[model samples]
Target chain A: MPSDLPHSHGRRQFLKLGSSGLAVALIPVSAFAETDDMLAAQAELFGDRPVQTGRVSVDLPPIAENGFSVPINIQVDSPMTEDDYVSQIVILSPRNPLPVLAQYHLTPRNGLAAVSARIRLGGTQSIRVIAEMNDGTLWSGEKETLVTLAACVVL
Target chain B: MTTIRLSVPDTAERDEIIQIRAMIQHDMESGFRVGARGEFLPRDIITRFECFYNGDQVFAADFHPGVAANPFLEFHVRATDSGSFEFVWTDQHGEVWTDTASIQVS
Candidate 1:
């Protein structure tokens, strides 16, 4: 699939290294003042590919009375073998100050590419999941949720 | 750090579903207001959590700052075995906290 941003797609090839090492490229909040640069950086690392629709499933409660700890589950259909497998899974919150919340790297030894966790949301927004196959194919899924009580502020 | 409680059902009437409940104590700071003269409090939020059963992770999520303080989550597990389950939580500051609970089969 073709990437929406051509320049950003090329940057992803430079990042096929260690998954943990990619965290170093994440821009800090201070840099958010330059939203354009931040977007460019994010697109380079994340948006460079066309994410196939409906390849992954994300499950969450429809109405989260509280936001501090909302349950979430993600599962991808893959054989997960030594030769072909899911390399990474990324969770994105569109409205959060930092959209990229978590990234999980899996090897064939992991047995399954499914994960369940609790997440904090600032408000009601859409949560997006992007799954990257070992071959650089990106698949996406999204869900919109309503949160009653939000957390994560310094008061 | 607030106390956390987790419970797994003792037995399941069916083969596909098992109930699990989890609770944590915390005053999720919203970072919206200040104390006395307006001293901005520190932000202490759990950003992500995962559940591992028998070394295989069955659930995981990425949390944001908007979640309320002291969250409780409940869900079902596809009854596989009466093994141990582990929950790992990571706060906004990148600190990791973990708890373990075991399930018994009838």
Candidate 2:
């Protein structure tokens, strides 16, 4: 938070602003500004590795009646052998308050490379899925969801 | 205190793949809700979950506020031997909720 932000003001400083400033302070700061967290997440993880678009897919309802708990199924095409297995999978929501939803670490002991869970969606946005193989190869996939009732937003 | 629900196969064949499910009772407050007094609520949620097979970690997940409340997980594990599977979850405040299940392999 920047020092100029109203919420950073101390009680003494807030009192100095009087009634008009008090009202402004009461208004909570919200992230109305759009952010490209999807790109940010990829940069943080894979860096410059070219994200190949295949070998991974996500199953999600085309129209989410509610965004509170949208079910998502993730699949990765891997042999799950000791030599070549999916080591990690990162889920990202481009429009969510936090881009990185979760990172699942898998071992060859998993036998298969798939996961299912109910994840939250703030609104309509693309869900990005990235899989990292044991050998450092990265595969990617994406799907868009239409959220009727948005979550993670307050005005 | 928090309650945890775990689903592990009671029995399996050696080297067989088995599915495991775990759920935690939590509010998963995303910190985006505005209170009646018009203040934003602070985010409180489980930040991590790990599954250990016979004391060796086999699967783990790093969670964020984007996950739904009362987070549930479903994944697979190879039944290599008869042992115990321990599931543990840690919240942002460092509170932990854990449970264990035993499986038989023949």
Candidate 3:
């Protein structure tokens, strides 16, 4: 028996089988793994609708000595009327483990489309505010600050 | 547990922005680390906050883990009537705390 033809043919078969096996092995392991779980939830709220910039503002101290109790305020431009008004205001932090910090729901009866609160930060990061209107439009604003005392640092 | 104070002015003018203030004592852990154990503490968060006028919800918020501990939120709201105003905070663990004060329209 000539070894040339059998070896060539067998080599082709081995290469094909090896490559296909590699592809199959990679699929399930990758499927079960997740780099970021919070990203999915964050994207679900902000993915389809491109967040518009402006008409809302987030205020924070330029430098915060205490990350445990940093004051934050979100103000959105709205008439606060029954006919047309802001439906909700949401606060998001880009670097926080749970990014969406706080949210306020408003109606015409409330008469104010602003919310004030204190937030904890792990480090220096940008805080975002997304104001959702009754008509289904989202307006965004951001503020950056330095955190001298990082929140979440265990030891 | 600590006493939380909430106040709305007695002679708050209508349509005229009136100051509202709240102060609460809480451990607002940053969930980053624990001092003694040298381990990351699980995130504990306040999920909702509400302010009521005459027993009606006037302002509300759904808070997250980023909120600092012992939070105090102050803002302005128009006083439409003479009644008691209430402030309430609910944590993610289902703990609820509240404070109230009377408001009089002048």
Judging by lDDT, tell me the better candidate of 1 and 2: 2
Best by lDDT: 2
lDDT of 1 by residue, A1-155 (tens): 66798777767765655554667567465444434543453576667666688879999899987765778888888777667777788777765656665666655544566766667776677788788888988887888899887643433
Top-DockQ structure, candidate number: 3
In model 3, what is the error at residue A32, expressed in angstroms?
A: 21
TM-scores of the candidates are: 0.54, 0.85, 0.77
- Contacts from the true interface found in each model, as a fraction, amount to 0.21, 0.91, 0.76
Report clash pairs, candidate 2.
none
Clashing residue pairs in candidate 3 (N, C-alpha, C atoms within 3 angstroms): A120-B66, A152-B32, A154-B33, B28-B69
Local accuracy of candidate 2 as per-residue lDDT tens digits, B52-81:
999999999998888898999999999999
Per-residue lDDT of model 2, residues A1-155, tens digit only: 56776665776576777877777668543422334457867888889898899999899999998898999999999999999999999998878877888899999999999998889898887799999999999999999999988886542
Model 3 alpha-carbon drift over 4 Å, by segment: A1-41
TM-score of candidate 1 on Cα atoms, chains taken together:
0.54
DockQ of 3: 0.54
Alpha-carbon shift of residue A50 in model 2 (angstroms): 0.7
- lDDT by residue for model 3 (B1-106), tens: 5879776777876776676778778766556656566667776766777888888887777766677777777665767888888888887789998888887786
Model 2 stretches astray by more than 4 angstroms: A1-35
State how far residue A152 of model 3 sits from its true place (Å): 2.6
